[model samples]
Target: MQKTNELSNLTKWLDQFPLFHSGDEVDEVRQKVGHIFVPHNLNVIGQEQHLSADMNHLNLENTSVNTLKYGAGVKITCDPFEKFLLIMLPMTGVMDAEVENGRVKACNDVAALINTSDPLSMNWGEHCNQLIIRVNKSLIERTCETLLGHPIKEDVKFASALDMSKGHNIYQSVIHMLATNPFLAESAKLYPLITKQLEHLLASSLLLNQQNQYTQKLLNPEKIITPLYIKKAEEYMNEKASEAITLQDVANNVGISLKTLHNGFQKYRNDTPKNYLKNLRLELVRKDLIAAKLEKSNTTVTEIALRWGFIHLSHFSESYFNKFGEYPSATLKN
Candidate 1:
């Protein structure tokens, strides 16, 4: 009953958005949805009934959120999703899927993460309505590389089942925010900074939270003894924190490979070098914001953030909130 009510509420919440696709015709609905996602074999099953399908989609730069329902039982099969990863959360009824990991019946508490290049199939219950998050393949790979401080040769493979009961509600919250937030509605047009950060957030969240090929390595990055050169690298980073520097630049200055620099930071600082530099810049931004607040200065957050090498305001604001438990504007105000 509780799950049903929650799904009902979510359905209502999603209905506020204009429909992106809907129809009672099988071929038309299938083709429309295929264009939005990918071409797939969508077949009606069990009954010879007129099709009833509807979809609501929101597209971002590197990620998209979609709510889909085929008001009749349907079986869908497709080749590997070669370009993106799909996270499927069934809002009502069951969705049985066969992916690389194995077969799983996704329902209220169970979600699906599909990323492998293996052919897969799914059977959606007649009343099934699902919320799907599509993230770009290259985005995930790039985020993984940033975390490992090196390029990955193989694709990131995620376990098919996502146990949403175990604190995975963050995805829904983010989706809800995207759907309802007025600023976000116009973010892509007027707030590229926000979209960039949101892109990073989604990519990072998937890599950090989902069970993937790099899970163990990411959790326990090889703990080597911190070397003197690692300390020197930190010093170099501190001195150059205000400059637009890349991981390669830091490694080059320390006369070490990116992998070696990552190992040192992981072992000694319990973080990736990329994050270390970000936190350093965030601290500088906060300090400056606090001073501005005290002096009643008219300097904008954008100016201070850009001065400290943060190009994306939304990303900077999100990072500021994560670090200080408040937005940069709040810091500037109070």
Candidate 2:
């Protein structure tokens, strides 16, 4: 499913990872590189005249993760991501990087934690292929608040470093999902049901293990994300998804705070309430398209989309594609 007009600006094809080939165009390559991950100037190194940048990426709001390959030697420079944080590692090839205060040796045995709001730089070795996870700064910070059961007056800043050898299990879980499973496990993108689970789980893991101001609080097992509360929230959203219901509205209806609602969903569904509602709306819209097609009705894509509260046509279409791997009109074609 390709991104519809509404979602094309910020999403990839529903089932595609949005691959790109730079054809030695450094500036052009940098733009795509910058758009999905962060702004960076990529320069080919030492006799590497024919530099080609290949990349495949996805945007999970809080987790805009991707894999990039610059077919030869190159160096990348960038400022901190304004509102995001990054977790980067090499899936293949060696990288000698100095980010913030940590130095990844030539052996490339460790991952780099980057504060997108802090200045950072790195150099990529020839033949290096890397996996970069870019997550929204606010989302991670909010997760801390949920864990601690209180509002945070200060922004959460993670340590500028991580030793991958220490949290091997969590890192391995992320890698396994990226390499195989319902998320990036196969050639096609998983639907929202699975995609959200993977993203929430992996993103949560990053906040949980990576050294941060809220590490101890997040690690506490005492927080009660009552499953009953989660179900109540889910039920309310499922019933009102087509009625312009926001996360707050659902949270209120469920007798829980918005933050607690988020925590509950994260614990039980491995998803955020907003995403879970969006998923339901997407599924309903798809169903309507299929029904209209079967009945040979006069319904248009806009009608069906709007009925489901997807007023932003292009984003809705892209989101539809993101879930169904095809456009709504295609599904309803006469």
Candidate 3:
């Protein structure tokens, strides 16, 4: 039923006060939340005493959503949105979220990264306090292109599940954003530099970490790589080998485009940027393994290798043997 009494402050309404109305009120809520997100159709699933939402913008580029709702449940649906990528991270309760064919069981540690072009729906549990982020779509796409050194042929897609487990840079970035709750809670606005830096950081982290259509090429550039872009890309890589980075990131940091970067690596190094970076990390890891062994310490291959993004232990071992003429373990012992 349409209730005209709902507060117009949907983005800032705290649920603590005795206020929430009906379907129409919730619709108005959706409209107010638009400053930070796209409008969505919300259906209240059960009778509830309090259903409230509050949002704070880091800037036009990012918005943080704080919501508390109680009832049997609620569903929020959206078709393709012209802007913003929706990322929902539950802090108190679980939310069942789906985007196209991918489903995410969102909890305190897991989040749902949604691409707005795909139809999305979320079912929130009776008691849920969730934090949501609406990231600017154009900013992300542009960053992706800069990293790729080329235009994207398909929509930028993100893996449905955002695992907050250790080593996932995206998860760490999200946590860093949340840690800035003081600024969000202090005022409805933020300094341009503060917010813009945060938005750019999130965009960069996701493009580098999230598994998407461009992941393989970004991670392991091949067949097309050449020498023109090689020296610059290699210098960039050598400068930041310890950090989590992709070929696209290197391409972006270097003043070259992805195609030109590929040409440079091929022409000079006769190797793909990805391959060179991988070997560099492997060599670094071997050096550490040997030093650890010499010290008679507790260092192990698995622990040392994972730190360098080497997940496939067998493959790493094989490559280590090929490059050094001995297994990693042997290298460590010697």
- Which candidate has the highest TM-score of all? 1
TM-score of candidate 3 on Cα atoms, chains taken together: 0.54
Worst 10 residues of 1 by lDDT: 1-10
lDDT of 1 at 64: 74
Question: Can you rank all candidates by lDDT, best first?
Answer: 1, 2, 3
Q: Residue 266: error of model 3 in Å?
A: 18
Per-model TM against the reference: 0.64, 0.57, 0.54
Best lDDT goes to which candidate?
A: 1
Candidate 1, 25-58: lDDT as tens digits: 8778878888877789988987746457878876
Which residue ranges in model 3 land beyond 4 Å of their true spot? 1-24, 47-72, 166-171, 178-181, 184-194, 222-334
Candidate 3: RMSD over Cα atoms?
18.3
| lDDT score of residue 167 within candidate 3 | 57
lDDT of 2 at 245: 75
lDDT of 3 by residue, 1-334 (tens): 0011111122233333223323236656667654345667777676663455434333332444444343446788877664567777665568998788578998766778888577888898866655566665666765676676654556688888877644547645554444334454344343545665666677778877888888876776555544444656777888788889987899898866788777766665545677789878987997799679768998898888888888899999987765544578875764
Once fitted onto the true fold, the runs of candidate 1 whose alpha carbons sit more than 4 angstroms away are 1-8, 11-22, 166-183, 223-334
Which has the higher TM-score value, candidate number 1 or candidate number 3? 1
lDDT comparing candidate 3 with the true structure: 0.65
Residue-level lDDT of model 2, residues 1-334, one tens digit each, is 1111222222233236655855578888887777776677777886666777777776552466576777778877777776677766665666766666566543234667777566666777776666667766655655565566544555566776545543455754664455333344343233544655565666577678777777876787464555687778878888887787788888788788989887867765556778778878887987888788778888899998889898799999887664544577876872
| Candidate 2 runs further than 4 Å off | 1-18, 106-108, 165-168, 182-193, 220-334
